[model samples]
Target chain A: MKTITNKKNILYSKKELGQIQLLLPVILVVTVFSLAPLLRGIYLGFTDYRLGDPISFNGIENYKQLFSDEYFWNSFKIGMVWTFVVTAIQVSLGLGLALLLNSKVRFTSFYTILILIPWATPPIIRGILWRQMYEPNTGAVNILLTNLGLISAPINWLSSFEFVIPAVIVAGVWGEISKAAIFLLAGLQTIPNDLYEASKIDGAGLWDQFRHITIPVLKPVLAAIISLTFMWNFNTFGIIWVLTQGGPGGLTRLPMLAAYEEGFKYGYIGYAAAIGNVMVIILSLMLFMYIRVQLRERTES
Target chain B: MKRNIYIVLILLVGTILFFLLTRKNNNHQNIPLRFVSLAWQEGTIATNKSIVNEWNAAHPDIQVEYIQGTWNSAHDYLITAFETGDVPDIFHYESSVIIDYAMRGYLTDLSPYISSEMKNDILDVAWATVTRPNGEVDGIPFLIESLVVLYNKSLFKKEGIIPPTIEYPWTWDDLQSAARKMTKDTNGDGVIDQYGAGLGLRNSANIIMNTSISFGGSFFKKEGNHFVVKVNDEEKKLLQTIVDMLYKDKSVSPASIGETGAGMIPGLFSGRYAMLVGIGSWGRQQLVENAPKEFQWGVMPPIKAKTQTYGASTQTLSIPKKSKRAKEAMMFIDFMLSSKNTARLALNDWMIPARISCLSMPEFKDKIGGWDITCSAVSTLSIGSWLGAPGYVEWKSRVANPVLQELFAGRMSIDDAARRIEHESNIVLSRYKKRGEVW
Candidate 1:
């Protein structure tokens, strides 16, 4: 077979040639557009490439700087905390809401639309609106709480180091819960109804049914949703930039924000590229695990 | 033979027609000049559109292409344009980045293009902003908004505290004492219903630097070839007072109030605070439109410690060096910053005219409220060359601000905060030091 394929004249069929022709555009696009820029970015990671300035190969200088930089490490810690907390909260809230909406309920459509309002709002707008609500004085949150006699003074939500991360997490959950719910709801609808009915008749309470029939049936979907939401929350930059600017002493400075500060504010393009390369490696590992699980689950099924 | 002759004839005719069309198109169309300006606010967007439209109508040979930009992404946007060689003919930028852009050889020197008379027309402080250390005039100042203390007159009267005035500006002692006295429990709820003052202490590096300057302190001293951090006793004293006001006195608005776009304006407008310490003339229009009609306000120079001082940002118009339409952009800049046009813009009462001659216009004097006091505050405007020092923004955001916030939060002593700022700033500034440069 190898000998036979080695001959150029072996392609004696027009149909095979037509299939190869049809795939050329996609191959060309990937090569020229996607792969080229990725390779160039990787090259930039090792250079001193300030924008509009002369660039030269620096031989790991950027990464060397990254290793010793206190701010970079702080940003990594903050990004991990932000991503983990936001993803956990969003997934839990999304699962709960998906189950609720999946049940018999009146005005299901109305509830769906209402829940989507936060998701429909742009991230920057959500950041601004939430920042306004978190205003120390004259904000809706403060005014409402004051009126309810919950506290004697308005809380400093965004500027207190202790409260800034939690406040941003609240905004993050508010903006992202609807997206998770919608995705999980779609997955939930795909599960067979007979499984739940069968479980109920077999002396299973609601909790038992959820633990056995619901969770087992929806495991793959849940995994996929969680992974996707994890990536989304991990890569979030606009909301934090708009709301806090990674401030109140850099409490909310995610890796992305730190990268922007290094590249744009400090004009350290090479250092920024090194940080981005690290993020890409982390995200790639996550995606690799997700893909492995997907393949394994498919083979098992 | 007949087919070949027809094909040759057709090709010849097509080539002739294409050349004719190209020539006609090139001769008839105007040169396109792209201009980018701030569009993050409705007022600015409207103003930019109006000015562009007026300019286009008047200059038939030069068509203006307007691009709206936001402050959050403007730096990256402009820099990307430069890297890609697609720079705009003209762009509006904050004064902070003018030195950086000029140093990078992005901005065209305007001194050759500008007349001495035109240069002399602008305020000295405003002109100093665009003039680089190498004496290159790289930008034209279009607007200047001087910082001042804005106070609610009604609250002061009710508290039996005298309002600050230009002639009798509040001293640091008077400011604190008055602020303490004005803190009140209006509703008998056992809680202070009103804050005495609101100074933006969160993420306000400019305000802090200006405050330190006012207290007779300098953040950096010029050595033979580099800047050395010199913020010592005076700066610590200045920060201690602010921290005391926030944590001990509790007479000031919460530091968190400064973290939002609403800023202290909302607090002052809602009567939650009697005074706003570091607001500019830009906030004057907001107060006029949003403050209750019964709520009267006054403007005074910033509080004096050993000296009366504040910082000013002169929004600038610059022509990119790579712009094909540099001459046209200069023309547009001149037209925009002309005395009549500056005065007209000042009539909107949102910005003060950068042109000294425009400031003398009766329209600026009569049409704008608190215009005189805002202009008078310009004399006390101390231009900090250190603000434009290389790597200063990073030092401000990463080093100075975080340490200062710790002091304000009572997590660190004033001495420690000052020492940390000075040490970190020196480390950052060392990277930018040259052999013979001085501030």
Candidate 2:
């Protein structure tokens, strides 16, 4: 009689309890896969654990070593520069293309589809194709350049320290810009045509209307795109790895590549984990700052 | 409706549980063995397919499965697999990585399983790579690779330059002069249409180490139980000379520093380059498939410096420590290394069989062109040693590669590069020094 009364007085209503029971599979999946791995990685970061060896606690030695390591810092610097430059260029180009496509031009859909090809293709395939195009000889770019008398000789686009990073950036942007453009195009569709019509009737020129109406209207979309683009560029590894392998004297070495070399190639698993942990922290900080800025802007408006 | 949904969910969960339990039971009964490899080439695939068929045919109780991985990400994937305690029973790895894996205790020691007769049949240098300093063999010798000069016979004939003979093997200087003579501006367009050689220095450390060893410069000197890098006088001289020949002499293409996509033997293939220095394994393949019928190609012994020559160490097969079927894994390795099977695999794979008897098999000689020369070059592995140290992998990433790149790009002086490598390598080495491990 007491047990029946206690069950009846439970916080969850019968319907709510049934609903909660239905969510067990989702909860189990999150716990087993995502949460478990995250916890394991964090735990291993503080231990002197090799891949197959008996793990031992090492406190913060791995983290300390990372802080002092010149290579790690260099890679961080490269990652930041890469993230900023690629994101800015890709976003602006995407927005510009989006605006152009938004116009009532003939074959606009066909042109948009063609531009989307790069984004639709796999990143690995895109990287390989771009690498071929950037080849020093027999590549389309060099052949075209030489034929047009733009340059007397072929350029080693992915070979030199100076050119390799920029070459990778161009390839990365090629893939990313298309996606950003499509996203912005969708955002552009949401803006009512009457807003532009009203501005034009009031004798507003293209630049003024774009700045006052289109730019303000696209702010949220632009912010989201920029932040997401920055995250993507920062985490990019496949394109750079396939193209350069961070070569020509480590000019294009990024943090992820460094972490990879440390963990797998050299068997410094703990150190690699520490590098990963640092990346998580750094990326999280960037994300937080982005959100904070967005909130601040919203508050000010 | 809620009761009906709950009943459906219960049934689904029960079905999934039953399936998983049955799968687990089936796995246990069969003792499934998985072989993981990243050898994507046609020959390697053929060899793997044949091996799997043979293994399955021989062992009725045991079954084997194969997993394919891409070369670029295979090592990383394997490492993750090992960390998660899900390693394959057998895997292929380069000789350099064997030590790295062994040090991490990820490999099973195979010394006890290997017989004296079997050990005697394997080449000493190839065996040495798998053997730890304490005389524990960590892997089975799969194949041996040696460096040989691959030259375009037609290009040599066209230039009226007699190819180096077996009796009168060319020296490094002789090869360089020959290459300079072969290089030409065929179209007279002021740009060189033909190059003397196509040297790939993009993957620098391996090439540099091979060149250094051929020039008789040992990167490390064995002292008691340990090895110390001797980047002092002799090594520096060798490093400088190679850099000078590669960049200053311009015998190799200037574009080689940045351009490797034109293929490893582009010059030889396109009739633009006269000579290429590459692994003997390449010569074996050229003998079988790649050699143009219009032009006869031949192998020259590796160019002699102070020492005879050196080649990048070939890959070996190892059983991961986490493998449940270690005994069966050892048996598979033994079968793979057996004279009959090795010779059979070698015939198709176009690599020097690690087994001594298989290498001497006359059938290999008749199968392809230039095999005679390649076999001879490979046999010289008796003289040279594997080029790796305890921390050699890290040294490669931090010092050797970057320094060599600087050398190739003409950004740093050879002496400066050598000094930098020495300093950086010591720092890398010191980390392992604490563990008391030796190269």
Candidate 3:
């Protein structure tokens, strides 16, 4: 009996050891490729390292310069506005679409799949398609509008600074709304039918039930989606770059575009890295706040 | 347990297979010469590929590979590669970036390699554009381009305006009158459907400088070899006058101010504009490929400014200093620039051959549909006249572009714009001074 027990214990230990060995490769890969590069980038941000030159310590000069740079500040303001507007619209539309699809409506599955097309397509392709659509003349949108007698002439959608950002946001939201909708739709599936039935039994109206049960239940998922979307929108460079190239007097210049222009076009790598580092800090604080709110709500519930 | 043993065996086999494949790839002895280029048009790529193939065939010891990237991304890609010490053997670069790269010790000077005869074969302007002030030939001269005034012949005939004589080109006043006459509201619409002229706001400084020179205004007075801008007096007035015509006269389209979809070159090709200011290389192709047969177009000689006309620098090929195959690369470049191949490549690509002998060749002239017209447009460069300036790259980025943007927005007067440019340009120059650098 003792020998048999010892053998069982040894077998269990061997299995556990084997499982840890299997996980080591994945852990090493993530550390090397993702975490190490990110940490190294942060370290490089503090140095005055031009391309093809040896790096040297610069202390707080880069940061100090960034603080006073008008272009940087303007891009930061634009980034914040972009994040807030895109996040609010994306979340509201996504939740609404998810709720609509969650109901016992006809063709719900087909419609859900159809909405995923934009999300499934590449961001560059989406940007290019939207650019063609928004072309001032000989574009589908202008042609349709003119035929409908909506306007007398074509609108310069991208040329005007006032319209360029919104035009980019329209394309950005097309992708983001689908992603958020899918996430919320999955969250909706987890809600028990009994909960809604109980609410109805208590004589609560549909709006009241949604306000009470659905939103509260979706709070955690919604917070996560919004935080992720905000980060993505803050780093949104491709759509704007493809459409405007931060042109027409730099009105549409986002933080990422500014960083790219400085680093690549202007050959100011150290300054660009500083800009990137500040962006990371801002995004990290935002994420931390979001996670704190979510955790706090969870504990209270 | 038996299934686990089979899985282990499969994993072992896979590892061995991967090792063998990698080893096989590593065992290849011929070092591949990688060439990165921004010239990715079908004809350009085909020509490059043929050259690479020919070189490889002759030199079996080395194999060559070519990577094509877009113009917008090529500079960034090359910079990144240089930083990483992975630069290709040879690359195509714009004239603006040559000094910047050469100053950083990224380019290999070719002065020591080429024969004097071969150097003399290249045009003097082409040679000057590629050579640094210190007499260092940092890049090999290949093709040369000059800016030309392209006007629609049909429009000129319809308006009964004689084209400018090549010997005595039109002045700014003549250009203004021509443009005013050309602009029309065809179909009796309140809006003007046809524009008189189109200038690329994208490179407004080049156009501005060209126009300014015609007004007898020099950007700088050369003292010995050093160039300094005459920013305060006549040049300022010339700049104001040009801007007034562009914005106040309303002869050009509002598209210059970002109102319409009509971009400069494409607008000209589509018959939306009567005249266009574009580079000779691009203009040559535009005439051949897109211009309608019945719509005749003629090239106007470079507009004169007090005995000279405005001309910009052109493209050159350079090898990276870090390249292991510099000898072979130089040989290939020399072959490409030979009169025979140069003419062949230039004709196919619609680029002006840098070789003076090839310029008069019938094969070179007849490549594009409108040969004499295009030749006459750039003939001013044969004489010694150009829009040369120091800190061209910095001036373009920091001063000229922003001020032009303001002008396009109609937010600043031409005088105010010139003053603002002078202020900002001084700031940029001061920074360069602090660095103790001229470029």
Candidate 4:
């Protein structure tokens, strides 16, 4: 009788049961779609899971192979370099453009709209457009430079091992700067007018004002933007694929492109899963860094 | 609140159950098969769709739905479909990938279904391309195309040079001298105004294989339990000849360093290149459409080194193993590959007919500018299929492509490139060896 009473007590009331029923659909969807794939990907990293073959546990075999794989290491190193260089240039240019736009300039609205054009254009289209523009003999850039008497010969931009990475970086920056500028401009507009007036009254020059006032005020926004830029640039794939395909001796190969080649092109699902897991860990580290910076800023304030 | 929640739960469950109960169930008597094809040429795509629609109109019980696929994404799409078990019943894919699919056990062997009459109707090489080592026909060849040298007639006339012909195709040295003669800088400009030839950096593997075969040297030869990478003196000499043309003579177009192979067509049309080597028969439509009205172009067999052999890229249609409507699919394949239909497709498009009967069809006898030479070259050439190794896709894309690109870009030496390709290709081939797959 006591056990029966306990079972009755454990059962939910009508209202509680209704609440649980309402949330069940969302829980099921997440479990089936999101959680399951994530768990499977993790599990496959520990197993040899070639497509159409029976998966078997291989412990850390995939990861061990990756550690010794030269292509994997080269791609990772290049990925880091590309991510850092592209992000740094994008942020600096964005900040500079924001400052220029924030000034009392002519056609401010027109300039803002023009600045948004690259941001609005799709990345894939931008990659193709830039690839054409970088062509050596007939490209518009070469034509202009030749007319300007800048150089005697057309430079092999896309095919040259030395120039391919920088060429892609320039294209990446051109496509990305507009969004970064817009984001920074939004932050700039939120600065109170009275702060700038007080700084001017204190005889602060432009550089001094920027260093002391703007930088301090924009720190949080800049941190967010930089963190997001790092994440996006680290995972960049489509543009590189369209432009170079990591060619001319794999000079521009990135970790994401390598992962795609391994998984989709080569059908090495286990190896690709291991690479993907490593990327996830790296991204998680970046997120932790972002959080730490935010916490530091909060404490400082 | 409890009553409302109860009402919502009941409604959702009832809706799902209603859908489950009312879902359309296809009948066993009527079989529907899906056929996917690449949008290779506009005319070919239209003709294929028309053929399928006609088949559907006549056959009520067995139907095939046509799905168009783009060249770039079709490989990935097929792989994804196979993974999900949603593959089409009949799909057209490149011959290079058919071996991979066959080895993976994803394709049905059509050996028993192929009638002896049909076997005799198709070209021996075309039939051999689709057959596995175990003597199982996994696919039916749809279109056959071979690479040939196309020269600008006006340019040759202006240079007072007789172009290569089928009876006496230019040897490597003869071709080199012709290129040098054709290359000139009009208006005394410091830069070259006309190039003698344009060779593709990406498709270098195909050209290399063709050249090596012409010189009687097989680059990839099957040895005991593995394939040996042997680049003999003849192959080395061929590579040296190309390097000399590009770097020393500077007669070959520099478009490889500027534009991709596919993107070099406009250059050829604009008279930038006097000769385009290793251009396939499919390039005729593009030339006719894009070239200047007065531009005169003629085709010849591929240049010879020591022999006259040619490699053909034959795209085929296959039936997946998982398909349930295999018989219906086989019927559809037969209808499509019949002599009349094959000739119709070949006439509409510039593709050389794979069927022996279709080669003599009235439609193919008409004088299309490039068809005669291309057809002759494809049918008579005794070279084995190129890039048909077990892991040829990887070897081509990863090893051959990049190594040649590096060599062309002047980043790596020819010896280094060859060595790296052999090493990397062997590594890739090892994957298949571990699985005990026959090349």
After the best TM-score superposition of candidate 4, give how far the Cα of residue B99 lies from its true spot, in angstroms: 0.7
Determine which window of 10 residues in candidate 2 chain B has minimal summed lDDT.
B379-388
Give the Å error, residue B293, model 4: 2.7
Best by lDDT: 4
Model 4, range B1-439, lDDT digits (tens) per residue? 6677667767867877887665433334464788998846778888999999999999988888899988788878887877777778899887768877877778889888887777899898887777766688889886786777777888889889898777878898898988988788886868787889887665477667755777787677777766656666777787788888989999888665534555666777788888887766667777887788888988876777877776665778899888777778999999987888888787666778888898776656555567767777764555453344667776777777777777777777778877887788777778767767674
Write down the lDDT of every candidate, Cα atoms only.
Answer: 0.79, 0.76, 0.72, 0.80
Of 2 and 4, the candidate ranking higher by lDDT: 4
Question: Order of all candidates by lDDT, from best down to worst?
Answer: 4, 1, 2, 3
True contacts kept of each: 0.55, 0.81, 0.36, 0.55
lDDT by residue for model 1 (B60-162), tens: 8888889887877788888888876678889988677877777677888888899777888888888887787667887888788567778888888888888
Best by DockQ: 2
DockQ of all predictions against the true structure, Cα-based: 0.35, 0.59, 0.36, 0.47
Reference-based TM-score of each model = 0.87, 0.90, 0.88, 0.90
lDDT string, candidate 3, B33-102, tens digits: 7777666556777887787788788878767777777877877788877776667877877665676777
Ranked by lDDT, the better of candidates 1 and 4 is 4
The true-versus-predicted C-alpha distance at residue B349 of model 4, in Å, is: 3.1
Which parts of model 2 have CA positions greater than 4 angstroms off? A1-27, A106-112, A151-156, A290-294, B1-32, B37-39, B66-70, B222-227, B258-262, B363-368, B382-388
- List interface RMSDs for the candidates, in order: 8.8, 3.0, 4.4, 3.4
Model 2 chain A worst lDDT run, 10 consecutive residues: A20-29
